[model samples]
Target: MKAPRLHIPIHYLKGVGPRLAGDLEHLGIKTIDDLFAYYPYRYDEYELKDLAEVNDQEQTTIVGKIQSEPLLHYYGKKKSRLTVRILSGKYLIQVVLFNRPFLKRTLTLGSVVTVTGKWDRNRAMLTASEIHAGEPDPGSKWSPVYTACSGISVRKLRALVKQAFIQYPDCIKENLPAAFIERYRLTGKREAVRTIHFPEDQEQLRQARRRLVYEEFLLYELKLHAYKQLKRVSQNGVQMNIDRPAVQKFIEALPFALTAAQERVVNEILSDMGAAFSMNRLLQGDVGSGKTIVAAIALYAAAVSGYQGALMVPTEILAEQHADQLDGLFAPYGITTGLLTGSVRGKRRGTLLRGLAEGKINVLVGTHALIQPEVIFRKLGLVVTDEQHRFGVRQRGALRLKGKEPDILYMTATPIPRTLALSVFGDMDVSTIDQLPGGRKKIKTYWVQEKIIDRVIHFMRNELEQGRQAYVICPLIEESEQLDVQNAIDVYTHLSQALPEFKVALMHGRLTPEEKEAAMDAFKKKEVQVLVSTTVVEVGVNVPNASLMIIYDADRFGLSQLHQLRGRVGRGNVQSYCILLADAKSETSKEKMRLMAETTDGFKLSGYDLKLRGPGDFFGSKQSGLPNFRLADMIHDYRTLTVARDDASRLVKSHEFWHADCYAPLRETLAESGLTQTVHLD
Candidate 1:
């Protein structure tokens, strides 16, 4: 019997050892399958060209024979340069190689070599970036350039890949079915893998890439659909009785009316909850779009049915904020509300936990503490997580497991682009709140240069004199030598000195929880007239009286983030303003400022942000559950993604596909990949 070649440890390969395997692991390669599946980010062409046809400063490749002895020179410690003369056709071109003295041993007289680099025709020189000994086959000239790190080189990666192709010629088995392959006109899995690492021509490279990209996307969509399928079949959904009278009374008693969009989404959520299946929904809305009220209505419905509800946030301050807001909303209705956080200790924590277990707390709001094992729910029917991306899949699953298949509703103030929504939130239904509340004025936004600091300060002072609070946001908490931008501390000091009459406070992530709460609470009240902070105040910090927002180094932030910071103001009926102080010199930076000044639509800005920064950086950093595609770009390959999604959805819904013999390959691949192993199928 042949051993499982695909699963063999990478170090067992001909040239790779334990140390080299560890380095390869950084590039997400650990086994023989992983090594074969590794694809290049780009390819470099080394097609031999006629020396006479190449122009100055052009990237040209030439094959020649050495005519002179290689001259080696050492200029400094640990630095050496090698220069040689090579004759190609009728031209004698000079080749310069820097810091590579060992190459002198290989470049003997009359030895043929191939060099590719910029050709300085006027100087009769070719500055070589790549050099090889006697390289030329008819159709194999394009070289793959793998992304490298500290311990690995592109050459070594190429060599290892070559060794794999030669030794394990028939190791990789096909993952896609023959019918599907024929329908899509895709290359076979083994051939595609080999071609991706070393393609004979451009057309073959394109075909290989398309095959792998489609496969990746199909598998990804299949995994997501499988999760959705489990939820659909669980049969643990709660049928809650929405308290129409109590919900109406609460809404009528509110100071403002709900926007049409919010009402539509509320009905959608209520409809999902009343169904036989559980509700896995994502509520998308801009800042101050009244998502809390919609969530409050759902919680109220759950409470009326004698089932408990929990609201989890990313920060303690936001938790407390939600608790306070919900307390006021639930007070008159006689529904109990409680807060549990990391700071709640001993007797308080014990009391909260007991209240949760005894069903005394109808709705509990807290941070990560809400997911801890100590807290138990009597009958959890609804789980709402605010700023959903801040928590990972496991965190959300942990909260869901606190109950028996509780309905989940994720709330985000950040508007997710449609492409991301299809992939990241593919398993959940989405509801978007596009309209802001009535009586809210569009915040006046301005883009000013650093030279007009005095004028901007004078304008802010006027707003301060009118008893309105202001927030000054910087990108960093402390000065960074690498980035020349304003820090929170420096801004706080400067503001304190400039406006001595007003109370100024500083807040950042480095501060303790207690200290951060104190600063935020002071600013929330009218006690602190000016708040200086970093992006810590971006989410869940709402102050109606604070009408002025000045973000320093606005160019450093993504458009969506800048919109969120701008949202900190404009909560009240008063005329608010967002002053973007950035020396935006580049066209892209200037366009960002212009767009911020032109419109206040969060969705529009988010779409642009997704385009400007790819999916990986769109969330500022890689969110835990976001898919890592090797060759498929969420933006560029959207058509392929859509087709894959459609195919996956169709197949997942078909019962025959799950049990048929033809799909055994797909089933085996899905099982062995372990992508859905952690899904909460139970």
Candidate 2:
């Protein structure tokens, strides 16, 4: 049988054999479609310019004839340079090339060539970045620059692409409707695919890129909208009875009043819970915002409705913190609260598991242990996950699976930008607690050098002496030979000696669950006046008495993280302060420090952080949980993303679009887009 057109294996291409195909596979190009989808990361523009018109340090392309022999010089080990003098018009430009001694054999004397790079006009020098043997063509000014690896040159890949297009010119068909394309002024799918690799002009290239980006965003948004519709139409939720009187009574008995923001979020959550559809809401709040109290109301609603409520936190310490607060808050209302962490084992674990199975546990709070197989719930109606990003999708899904169809609520203290929130958590309804509790003061922040650290420590000691606790945060758990930053172990040792009169303890990820609990418990009880720890304590370790926080290598962290670390203090009204100890070398790091010292708004900081670090680095260690789009950027192309989302919303609103014959191509492309696999619509 003849080879397929669009789905043909890459090895079957005109020039790419099995060996070359293996190299292409490493770049995720295994078939004809994959090869086409692998778009260039950037483009290089080479425009023929007069030597007199080019300025120093400006990039320009010049055509010249080699007037001298190319000299090859070897400098550093495994490094060589090729130098040649080329006569262009009245200017004899000296061209320098690095690590390409083989070019000396190809560049013959008196041969006409085109060179592109930064111009050193004063010295009549052109540091050649790209050199072509023939004179440059003004018509073909733009060259596609693809990411390449060893054994697979970009030139070879470009040649293969050109051959593939020529061989299968009609392989790609239109997946988008003609009307949608005309309305958006998007180029045809096949035209865009061809022009993206070999554009005739800049305007055509721009249109091609825009067309591809729009399609990527539109398909992703369609999946998100489809997921929302599926949840609403297919999944039946538990219709919970709203015990308004009991809820109000519980709220009235609280020691502190809830902010308006908290009340509004609570109302939004409760309305979702009481609806016919299951609730899938994300609760976003800044640090120190009363998110816990809002979650408490939802949990209480579940409990009073005669259903069990489960709250999962990231760390065991956070679990204990929630369990303690919930126990005190629920004890008076005749509701039983239980904690199940990795450390809670043997008979206690069995008793807790038995309580959960028998419906005796009204509210359960724990870490990953809550997802254990034996931890069955009699009626798990509502599930709340704190720091939801910390757990993988499977972990959260496993807990949700424990219930028949539980209302899901995900809470995060890290504030996400609205654009990102829409894309990443598109399937969930979002509620943001924008206001902090009344009477909460902003944490006074300071960026100090290492030389002034002694003064900062003295101030910390003064605060400790005044009966307030403090925290010393280090970036590393232990000493690192590669890094010159302070570690928790060394910081603890230094603090223990520097402040000999005060009690100090160490907390890090290496500590056992039991040990971490003990250290946190001691800090809670004021048994330890100073706690030197790593980022393991970055999340939710509420201590109202801890009025000071000192972070070492603070610049090493992203703005969101530094804000989270700063939030560890300022829990009470004792006038908290956070001193960032960092010798920030780069201007970017210095700007981060200045921004931190300038503002306490977590949302503001997070927005700046997203813009500064981009979406991938914003979440730090964890994947941004965003679909990988070849041409669309969540941050840079936010406006296009918004338009695509609106269009998708309109499209998904009509049921016919899901099964109409005209939409079959879209559905097929969507299946291959990989967005549906990332999002669960069923």
Candidate 3:
């Protein structure tokens, strides 16, 4: 079937020229589909009411003739004000405006103007927020306030959207099954799109959004199921039989018993690996939730089947840490573990690579170096990735191709919100380790202004004196040429001067890799008492002795980002504290920081972060292989997500929709939505 002309350039649409097209592109509306999909973030009710009808503290618009010319006045040297009086029948409306001296010339006596603002009955005045010379633009009772650029007016966007709706009502054909839409009580696509932009009432808008959100989620969920199926097609790897005696011996040697959550997730991974299909699962746990141990158990299970396993991390430090750990865990059990990273010397790296290719290495851990063509594996049956988001989707695909469809395990410290996990990781089965291990301490967090930096430093000193380390994270690595934000170098210098007794060091992206490793190694070995750094340390720093996270300009970070920084501390049981010495300028930033101080749950923080920044900036949809919803908010429409997921799962698995010609259109729709990159079959 031919696709509709929805992809046509939006400039060709009636009343939109090249100038308006450029403005529309800023709003990501290059095509008719883009314009229609660009829904309003908010709405304004421009209900015009009589001066006598408006109640105090109500915002409304009024049309009246100015009875007098604007009276201009100066309030001190810093303020200029313009005041005007309008007559509506016998009711005289006093309008006061500020910082609008140009309005003095615009407000002519006996001129008709529309004023919108709040009425203060006690003061007998109307504080005008906007004064229009003519009738309200679009002249509708309800007006949409789109997320627009400075050059594109909402009135212009509304007009353009209305024209597209009229010209292309048939563009969004009734491809959706009638029975399906009826079952969900969803309005038709054409009707829903019309109502979304210009609703008759709040009820209509709600109905329209419900339909749009559900359809988006349903198609997205279907694609996820397809992707999972596509990846597991060659799941012909050896079934990793569970050797209980060896596993028991390994667990007995651990310093601590696995938490119930960790044990349960290990069982899940084991079950997946033992199945005919290759195990594709996500091991989601909060920072310090012991996901590494769970993954270790899975690796042991894979090795028990006489096949090799590879664990990949984002940084060389994390790779080395995992190798150091796995060596200790797997060595006594007669499982040979190896490390292959960029920094490994010639002879040692050569031996490790040869051992891996010869199947002598039972488990190998490294960074992107693991995916290099030369780092061949003999029988790679399992692939484990720590900090999964640190690597791109293509990187994961590359690693998987090294083996004959190896069982994959992804480990993430980022606790994805339940809604997001269902949508984003729908292709992979998710096993969450929700509980911290026994004796884990909850990190006490504090939100304070930068004025209290002295007190925070004193606390840091007290911790350091007890043989603990602290981290000071600045928002920037160097003083930006434009912005006045704090940087790592200046923070290190300032901290060194103020706390002269401690060994303070600095690190940033600008430093060579070796220098960065040296600085981090020094901190890890307690050679540096305080480390001043940027977000570089945000990902894989796992120092247990670091008990204090002193973040400068903490308000400059998003909730999840601040939470991740806080996760750097609290890794040890040393009564860790996260002191946010932030100078929050707005109430929104203050609220965000307060939420950070209130809870350590990354899932909750993720929800708040999504709401604050939307899905586009939440994470890279392209790199992460997750869809960026144009309409549906995964958090707000969580129920819809679940419903759609279940329905999509059922449809994808059922005989009729699974292989029937009737489902072709839906598959095509999914392909058009860009799911084909990850979810479509060959």
Candidate 4:
């Protein structure tokens, strides 16, 4: 079947014009195809009802005749109001409009008009900004609302959407197979597209959403699988047949023994590193679960085998922490370590670069500075990245090219669920460290209401009296001019004055780099008894002496982020405690906070976090490059995604599309869909 052609200009299509087309460009829409694909974030229906059926606080569309002429009244300097009276029976209903004096001229006595708005019972009035002269048809019950700007109305945008759908092609290309659609009980692509914008009823809208969600997940999984196959066939890895003696020596030198899970993961990584093909592996673990120790072992092994190793972290503080920790770990084996970051400059950086190029620096740890052009390695055999999600695919590729397809080990403290990992990272081998080292204490947690603020402060004071440090975390750095929320600066000032005997330091994202480094240095040296800041210290600021963490407005943060913040403490042998303070407004927020108070398991918290917040905020919106889908609800559409993934896998395996005649259109779709850039498919 031939596809239909669609052509429509911006000006002639309903309410849009040259001016509005520029506004639409902000949303990435330029043509009829783009307009049809712009889905609604949500839907709300106004049930049509008679004047007598309109109840208080219910949104309804009522048709009635004006019993009296509309009156205009001016209040203060620039305020004006319009009032109209409508009679259904003996009862006269008043409709009020504020700041719209022009509405009085539009309504005349005995004129029939349809009004849509909420009715208020206390004032016994119908307040509406939407009033039309003629009664709308009762059969046109469902109203399609679109997002609007200042000059554009929802009704106007809806008209434009209708015209675009009419101009859409007659036979849209089917991206999924017919059998797959039957198995999932999904609607056809062409029909779904039309119904999504102008659905006949609620049922049709639901079906359209299901079909689109399935298509999205199916295409995503297909591209991921194809990339995995290509990588496996193209790359080669170094074969190192060294025994496990180096790894064992490093483990024995540690003050504590490794957990069984950690030991198993270490062995798995070693096996991959010794293979003929290069290793593209991910080491995922919960926060403070001892994944870094395993990574250190792998680095030591590479160094002892006369090869260089590099560990790249996301932040300067994390890079420094890793350099310090590894320096102590490899001291006994006579292995030297060096640090690289934006802070290092002049002769020091040059000396570090010389050591690295001359093979004297066996192990190097730093941030993205390691990927700079001036930095060269003698024979880099292994590259390990901390918090791999923080870096982009292109950045990682650039780092990988520094050596001969060096074995890549990516680490992330964010505990992604097993099912999601299988779909998102299908191209990489996964190793999990699910255990903590011996002698480490689990941090105790508690959820307190705002009413107990005084008591929480009293506890913090007692901890400070014992010569211990604490952290006071706020959600915002500065008080927003519009919102009345607690900020870091205000909290810091109040704490400093309240506890004059103890020193307090403040830090936030708005601070200069030098100021931030100074604050961190002071906290590390024990010069500050209390550190007030944002989540900037979540990932890699290790101060074992600080034993208390009090998060203000904890309900505003996600579970994974809260877990990462709590991980800042509990690094040493001392027992730590965390306090979560919420305003007790939402039951959902209370339940999420209670879950955090019950356990210290990062993976369990992460799973529950996904169920509560979904995938959008799991790794944060910036880290995870998945575009926000309007029709696909990750929580409600999990089953559809599962079915779609299975169907796509089966079709790819059974059909000879890669080498057959019916594959040309599929190839074109893949290129035009932007999957080529997303999954890096050629």
**Best-performing candidate as measured by lDDT:** 2
Off by over 4 Å in 2: 1-25, 30-36, 51-57, 68-80, 101-104, 120-125, 150-152, 160-195, 199-207, 236-239, 242-245, 275-278, 659-665, 671-682
- Per-residue lDDT of model 3, residues 361-431, tens digit only: 99999989898988889998899998788888889899999998789999887777654675776567899
lDDT of 4 by residue, 1-682 (tens): 1122343445555657788888776666677667777776544454556656667798766777898988889999989888988864455788888887877888888988877777876676888857777766454466666666665666666667777656545435676656667877889998998778667688998898888988777777666656655555465776666558767877897987888999888888888788777888889998778888899999988888788899999878788889999999997889999999999999999999999999999999998999999989999989999988888877788889889989999998887655466565656777887777667788999998868887988998998888789999999998898755678999999888888999999998888767887898899999999999998888868898999999999998888889999998887777788999887478889888989999888888888898888776675655544545657755567677677666656545544545444544454455554434222223
**lDDT of the candidates, in the order given:** 0.86, 0.87, 0.82, 0.79
1-682: candidate 1 lDDT, tens digit per residue: 1122247778878989888999999988998878888888887787778888898899888899999999999997889888999998899989999887879999999999988888999999998877888865466788888988879988899989989888876668887878889999999999999999989899999999899999999989888887777677766788787777766776788787788998899889988887768899999998888898899888988887788999999999989989999999887877899999999999988988998999999999999899898899999999999998889888999999999888899999888654467687767888889888877799999999877878887888999999999999999999899999989999899889989988999999999999999999998888999999999898988898999999999999999999999999998779999999999989999999999999899988987888888778886463656787888887778788888988988887776557677866666666655533323322
Q: Return the TM-score for each candidate structure.
A: 0.85, 0.89, 0.79, 0.79
Best by TM-score: 2
- Number of clashes in model 2? 0
Q: Which residue pairs of candidate 4 clash?
A: 237-278
Residue 321 lDDT, candidate 4, scale 0-100: 81
Give every collision pair in model 3: none
TM-score of 2: 0.89
In candidate 2, which residue pairs clash?
Answer: none
Models ranked on lDDT: 2, 1, 3, 4
Candidate 4, residue 674: the lDDT equals 42
The Cα error of candidate 4 at residue 481, in Å, is: 7.4
The order by descending TM-score is 2, 1, 4, 3
